[model samples]
Every structure is written in structure tokens, then in C-alpha cells.
Target: MVNESSVLFEKQGHIGILTLNRPPANAYHLEMLNCFNTSLRQAINDPEINAIIVDSSSEKFFCAGADIKVFEANTTEENAKMISQARENMALIENCEKVVIAVINGHCLGGGLEIALACDIRFAAKHQYLIGLPEINLGLIPGNGGSQRLTRLIGVSNAIQMLSTGDSISAQEAYRMGLINQLFDSEELMPAAVALASKLGQGPALAIAATKKAVYGGALLPMAEALELEKRLVDTLYDTQDGQEGFRAFVEKRPAQFTGK
Candidate 1:
């Protein structure tokens, strides 16, 4: 049975794993978006959650993207509302202080790909796993940051080809193009994703947040402005408890325990 919750939350140490739980294709229906938004915000606000890994419950499809049937049923205003909700879902990943990772084990298209694009990192299984923005097939464009983020990630030319042709690329191609950070054998995908998330969770949390802000913020800013922001961030972080612990731990040859302060 597909839980009415539409999402499943599991915490393992500092890592929060969020699985899209709508079975079969795991399509992004209105309820799914609401669940994702709520769960992501909860994870982000929880001080104990150092990172988040988004995966899927279904084995054959990470997410089949937006539920086109729902779109077809909606009026213009309703469409706008749905798009706005999806964008809010994207923001829950993008603007989060902790790391957000997408673990794609199977088909990831349209809104599914858009969600992955919003994350700081993506890892995919090597088999039939696919990734693309296929909204053009429905005579629509991606609404949830796919157009802009895809271009920023894989260049304007490739983004156009993927979106316009509605062709999904394999995990290898995505990795080669840097769309995905890593690709693993189908059997190893989840374990690898979780291992990576755990490794990231062990780092200094504030430093990770600052680094993410620096890169993501810099991507949208002028070089000079970005550099100044980074400078200020470095200065601010230098005074944090985690910063002091990091230095002290290095001198003492021990693992640093970061409080995320």
C-alpha cells in the first residue's frame, strides 16, 4: 500500500533519508509535493540532521516525474498553484543549510530530474536509470528550476537537447557530463549513496554549509561580489565553535566533533 504520507523519513545518525514512497513510478502528485516539502523542511530545521539523501521506494522508477494526469485536470490558476508548490519543494532542497543528495536508482524524468537538479549532489544507478527534463513532450517547459539549473549544470546546449528532445540519458552519460556526481552498479546504488551521505555527515557541518553557500551563491553572483561573500563567510566561520574544534582536533590527531555551531 502506498502510504498517504507519500514520503518516508528515516534518520541514521546525522543523515536523514527521505524516500519517495508512492509505489510503481513514484510520480509527483500534489500530495507527494506536499509531503516532500514538509519532510525536507523538517529535516533542514532539525539540528541533528547533518545531511539528507532523497531516494525512491520503487525499484524501477526513481520518479516518473510530474503526474501529467493531474496537470491535464487542472485549470490555468490551478496549474500555476501546482507549479508554485513544486518550486517551493525545490527550494526546500536548494536553500537548505544542510547537504541535499539525490539517489537515482531508476528512471528520473521531468519533475524528477528537476528535483535532482535542485540537490547539491546526485548519484545514479548504472543500469536502466535515466535522467532528463521531458516536459516538452507535454507541450510544456520545466517549471521547478529545471530550465535554469540544468543549463547551469550541464550547459545551455545540452540542456536544450535533453529538454527539447525529451530524451533521457544514461547514468554514465550523466556522470560524464557532470550532471550526476557519481554512478554505481545497480545493486550498489543505495548503499553507496548512504555511505557517501554518512561520510559527509562526519565533516564540520558549518563549514559544509558555508562551502555550499559559497558555491551556489557564487554561481548566481558577479565574481567580485561572490568573492566578497566568501571572504565574509570565512571570517564569520573562523569564530565558530566547530572551527575551533576542527583546528584543535587536527593538532591532537583526533576526529573532530562538530556541534554545527
Candidate 2:
């Protein structure tokens, strides 16, 4: 019997792959959220894993959003717990040093889209794959980082329109809005995501972390403040062992071994 809980974790070479495995319309639940948190942490802690790709196992639905059944039967305490679980799960993805690429193969709705938004990059299948935050339909807004992240990804105006209207958009529209990084055919989605992750895995891990931090960390800051932060970050990297290795390797015309120190 398949588990109705949240996730399935697997490692492929240097890439850690996480699948949202709750099937027949994968919907979020507390157990699933906990599982995702545990799995993401495990992947992050593994030094051998240089990157992560979050994908779905089911054909029709990447995730159908939060488990409405849980909400339907919920007490106030239960609702609070569920919200907390989701927040933690999204934080796991967002704060992870290793780059995460969300492979949006099917229905990427509500909490599903929120989780995907936490990733460093997103690759989706063509137009038919629906994606949006529809929590407003249920008398709620996205409790995770959806509002903030979506605003950062697209823009405040587009984010407000999408979230407020509770309208699902095609993957093509998402890409056009600068919400998704790339588009792939349905048959090629997994391979494309894997290829992208593998490419990232082979690069300097520390540099990737620096890049992620500089962009996301500085997004809300003033231009001068962001520039200062970037300068400080680059200076920090300059004094590190990885910096030395990178320079020496460049001089020797060889690939640098990044210890992620």
C-alpha cells in the first residue's frame, strides 16, 4: 500500500531527489509536512549531495494543495498545527544551502505552488499544467512564504492579482511572468530537472550558496545596502579555503575541488 503521507526521498548520484508522493491528488497534511521537513534536512546534511530536485510521482497532480479533508474536520488547535507544519516545511526548502529545483510536472496548486516557490529554481511542463495559490477560495491566504516569494519571483502587481483572484494559470503564463525559470515537455520534465540539478551539483557549492544568499537576502534591501552586503559576502569568500583552491586550480588549468568550507 502506498503511503498517503507527504514525501519520498531518493539520492541520484550527487543530486538529492524529493518526491511529493501522496497520491490520487497529493494534498498537504501535517504528517506529510513533517516528512518533507525531515527529508529536506537529511538531504541538506548529507555532504555528498550538492543539490536537490523536488518533483511529484503522480501523473495528474503534483499536489492538489492542502488536504481539505483535514481542514473540514479540524478543530482550531488542529488548524494551527497544520499551518505551523506547512511553514516549517517551506522554511526547510528556502533556508537550505543546497540549491533546490522544483520540477512542476502537473497540477501545482495552492500549497503545492507555495512549496515550489521556496525552491531556488522551478522548471515546469507546458501550458496545461495549472499553477496558482487558491487558498483565498477557502477563506484564507497562503500561510507559507507564497505572498512574499511570489512577489519576489514575479512582481507585487502580478502577485496580488494571482493571489487575490484565486485563479490558476498555465505553466506558460507562469514562465512569461518570470515566475518559472524554464519550460519542458511533460515527457522530458524529469530528465530536464535532473540535468539541471546535475549541472549545479558539479559546480562550486559555496559559490552557489553565496549567489543564493546575495540575491534573495538582498532583494528587499536598498541598492546601496545590497551592494554593501554583496561586497562583504565576496570578501568573506575571498579569505576562504575554497577561494584559494579555485584560484590555484584556475592557474593550473584544472577543475577546483570545492569542499564547501
Candidate 3:
């Protein structure tokens, strides 16, 4: 049985764990989407949090996708409101100050895959899980940045094939396609996620943020402009305490204790 709440949050060290708790398949409705945004905002706003992990309470479904019933019961405009919320949340995850990782231990489809795609890192269990964007079957396209992000992450040709066919791929196949960063056994999934978060937490927050900003922000710019942006970021980091500490630590052959300053 699942909890009544659609989203549950837990804080572990510098990591905030957001667990999807909807029954059946953790599909998103208005209530669930609101809860998710709330929980995620709480984590993002917490100064103590250095990283976040999105997981599911269900053993069989990371998320099946948006609840079709919500759309069925609403007018087209009403449905647009919900999709807008999802779009905002996806942007939130993509641009969060802290790193976000999606730990997928079960089926990840449609909006579910879009959610993972928005995350900075995705680690799925190397078991029976499948991942895909099957919105074509529902007479729709991916509405939550899936089409653009997927194309950017993988490539246009692969993204076109997947979006057009509405086909799902196994975890291994998804990994090969660069959909997920890593794969592990079901039992080791959470531990692996925690480990990665812990590792990132000890690094310089400002540098990490700048790197992410430069990479994502640069991707859309021309080569000349992107190089200038990268140079500007590097110059800014060189003036920070953490940056100095990193240089000193290297000289002294010691680990740098970053204060995220």
C-alpha cells in the first residue's frame, strides 16, 4: 500500500530524497503535481541540501505517466494548466542549484521519462524495467520538454524514432543510447544514488553550479559566444574562496574542504 500523500520527502545528510507515493503507478494528477512541486521547492530552498534524488515507493513503476483520467475529466484548457505545471517543474529540475538524480527501479514511460530526462543524472536498475516516450500512442507528443531535451541528450534521429514509434527500450538499451548514466541491481539502486550525491556534496558548490550553467547555457549558443561564457565562468570561480582552497589543497597534497562559498 502507498501513502495517501502523492509526494513524500526525506532529508539524509546533504541529500534530499523525494519519493513518489501515488498508488497503482505514481501517475501525475493535479494533486500529485502540486505536491511534487512543493516538495521539490522545499528541497531546493534548503541550504543544507547539496543534492537531490527522485525515487518511487512502488517496486514496479517509477511512474507510468500522467493520469489519463485527469485529462478525460477536464476541458482542453484545464488540461493545459496541468501540462504547464509539469513544464515548470521540469525546468525547475533542469536548472536547480543542486544536482538532481533520478533513480529508476521500475517502468519509466511518457512523462516519467521526461522527468528523468530533466534530471542532471539518471541511474536505473538493470532489471526488467523499460523506458520510453509513448505519447504518440495517446495521440499526443511529449509536452514536458521531452522532445527537445531528448533530442539534445541523445540525437535527433534516435529521438525521432522513439517519439514516432511509441516504443519502449530496456534499461541496458537505454544506457547504450545515453538515456541513463549508470545501471545497478534493484537492491543497490538507492545506495548507489546516495553514494553519488555524497560525492557531489563534498565538492565546491559554486564551481559545480557554474559548470552546469555553462554547459547547459552554452549548448544553445554559438561556439564563439559559448567560449566567452566559459571563460567568464572560469574567471569568476578563480576569485572564490573554494577555488583558492582547491589550488592550495593541491599544492599541499591534501583534500579541499569546500564551504560552498
lDDT of 2 at 77: 94
Residue pairs in collision within model 2: 6-32
Model 2 lDDT at residue 146: 91
Please tell me which predicted candidate would have the highest lDDT against the true structure: 3
Candidates in order, TM-scores: namely 0.95, 0.94, 0.97
Q: Which digits, one per residue and each the tens of the lDDT, describe model 3 over residues 93-197? A: 999888999999999999988999999999999998779999999898999999999999889999999999999999999899898899998899999999999
Report per-prediction Cα RMSD to one decimal. Answer: 1.8, 2.1, 1.8
Please identify which of the two predictions, 1 or 2, would achieve the higher lDDT against the true structure: 2
Q: Residues 1-261, candidate 2: write the lDDT tens digits.
A: 123356888988899888898878889888888888878888899999999998888988888878999878999899899889888878878777889999888999998888899998999988486899998898889888899999988989999999999998998999999998999888888899899888888877888888888987888799999999899889888868888999999999998887777
Report, for all candidates in order, the number of backbone clashes: 0, 1, 0
lDDT (Cα, 0-100) at 121 in candidate 2: 91
lDDT of each: 0.86, 0.87, 0.91
Q: Per-residue alpha-carbon lDDT of model 1 for 1-261, expressed as tens digits?
A: 223388988888888888998877888777788888877877788888888999998888888887878878888798788788899988878888788989998899888888889999998888866778878887888888899999998898988898889888988899888899988887898888888888888878889989988998988899999999899889988889999999999999999888878
Residue 171 displacement in candidate 1 (angstroms): 1.2
**Which stretches in model 3 have alpha-carbon errors above 4 Å?**
1-4
Clashing pairs in 1: none
